[model samples]
Target: MAEPTLEPSTEPTLEPSTAPAPEPMPPRPAVAEPTPSTAPEPTPPSTQRKAARRERLQVPHEPVTVHEATAAASVALAGIRERCTSAPKVIAVELDIEDGRGQVARLNFKPAAGFKAASWEKCVRGELESVKYPARAAPSHVVLRLQR
Candidate 1:
């Protein structure tokens, strides 16, 4: 009347009912062997890597106003772009804000052969820094970016 007694079951229960052991695997067949030929292969001439040229954008060489040069790369970017709506492809230019000293500002573009990106960014930045940038800051830089 006071308590109920329960006895534990004595049973060896197995989980993951083990399957029958598989038969021994057969050995793989022999692979074909390669033999060296007596004839020697000829070497090709040396070549240089070249940059890809798509469209030639005609960037006007004019005196851009101080205000217009902040995002200075707009016209050249627009000219270089294949599509109207998308932004042009940009490569980084590590420009020295000061002469020779490496206080760099970020500039992104591709320049023509013999053109220097660092100097160009410096020039663009100098022009803008000399004047107060407009509240609606227009692009002051004028460098070409590769069209996507």
Candidate 2:
């Protein structure tokens, strides 16, 4: 057998490629100034004063609680029972309350019950008008019916 001869290696060596890095961009501004058109214009003194006064006058308020309303109705009903000659009369009383104070706006009595006395309605109205409600932030309407 003949002996084999060794040959030189022809494969290339492995190495990392080198390249230039890109330049970084500049940072953007944090906030931009408001344009003249975007900004609100100043109003005249008189107009501003009027708007302030109107806003002040239009203060918000809350309605009276159910308990307070019931108390007021009870007081009115008791008064009605004492003065009303027509017992077992059904009547509806409507109250218009402003700033926690109430006044009778309407008094409706069932005509079929044969209770046509204006004095009874007037008396009930007087009693309801005197109802002092709890402090309320707004105006309220209350309707109470009297029966039994």
lDDT for position 20 in model 1: 75
Per-model TM against the reference: 0.19, 0.46
Give candidate 2 misplaced runs (Cα > 4 Å).
1-60, 65-67, 109-118
- Evaluate all candidate structures by whole-model CA lDDT and list the values in order: 0.38, 0.66
lDDT of 2 by residue, 51-78 (tens): 8888775534667655567676776677
Best TM-score among the predictions, by candidate number:
2
What is candidate 1's lDDT per residue for 1-148, written digit by digit as tens? 7697765445755654355788999999997564467456545433222222224443444434433433543333433343323332543443322211222244463333334545544444333234332222222333222322
Question: How well does model 1 score by local distance difference test?
Answer: 0.38
